[model samples]
Target: MDFVNEDIDNYAYDHTQIEDDLLWRLELETYDQLEIPQMLTGRIEGRLLKMLAQLVEAKRIIEIGTFGGYSALSMAEALPDSGYLITCEMDPVAIQFAQRFFDESPHGKKIVLKEGPALDTLKTLTGSFDMAFIDADKENYLNYYEALLPLMRPGGLIVVDNVLWGGRVLNPQETSDHAIHRFNHRVKDDHRVEKVMLTIRDGVSLLRKR
Candidate 1:
């Protein structure tokens, strides 16, 4: 179920700011090579993530997922020369695919791909982050939220993707849908942050730590 009308979504895509040549190439290559190419952040959300990072002036960022590195690269483009981004991914195939693009992008130097379970990788990470992007497996949405919340500095931003789970949260049946529903509620009730769910894409929830 599309939260945004198909035509409207395409219109927005058409009207939105364009990405660089490298990102365009990456998007095409991902669609060509990957089984689940939809996982790539695409133009709209990728630009949004870049804008959010820039808005926050995020020198330090962490990402829970690194599918094809599209989102990771998007955020990294917002960083300055001294900026740093650590993205965690457990899939070897995805890691390899994303690494190639990262190595090619000028902003790629800002990104460090951590290969392992995101939960475990988070444990080894240190220092407060200015922003975070969570786009990993749905089952661990809440868990990732819980784990990453403490790592976020006060007033830091946390952008969570796919909260709507293709609109399944309205009448959740699958375990992934239920997990996202629970995550939405959990964030809604949490007092440590201020949250707003946007209808963009599959549904993006922006959380500001207070």
Candidate 2:
């Protein structure tokens, strides 16, 4: 189910900016300890997240799923001195895994770990965020978008991960793929924002709210 060609992806990674030592350690440890290490965002997507954060001049970031904390750390590294990041994860084990690395990194202080259903955590949060990243349960993609949209600062960015669902979104072979397809269609039709869906990693949709 590789949406991206391995040769092309590897070549791109080889040519792109290298990840820092902390991220390299996290990447290695994830493979060493986790059953589903692939869930870690890896290098290309992680670097993209950091670049987006920098471009947006993000002072505050909200991450819906903090699997292994790679994405959170990537974005956190780009944040200014006063910037902050909030990452939500429901799995206790995953939170623990992410926390260990977050604690070790200097960027960890800027990250707030919210351990609960992302929707519940989103509801309790106040104030608009500069950027939001959604990569959690696929079934609730639209719901997450709706919940986060109103809380996003005007013109802020919202990045959704796994929109392609490994090319299955085109055929929609399963419930999750079907839902992701529907979500893609929903975003495509939204008139309030400008969106670009990229074939990066699995798939990434960037929306800038108007």
Model-by-model lDDT, in order?
A: 0.93, 0.91
Clashes of each: 0, 0
Off by over 4 Å in 2: none
Report the poorest 10 consecutive residues by lDDT, candidate 1. Answer: 1-10
Give the per-residue lDDT of model 2 (tens digit) for 79-185. Answer: 98789999999998889999999999999999999999999999998868989999989999999999998889988999999988888887988889889999999
The TM-score leader among the candidates is 1
State each model's C-alpha RMSD to the native.
0.9, 1.0
Model 2 lDDT vs. the true structure?
A: 0.91
Q: Highest lDDT: which candidate?
A: 1
Least accurate 10 contiguous residues by lDDT in model 2: 1-10
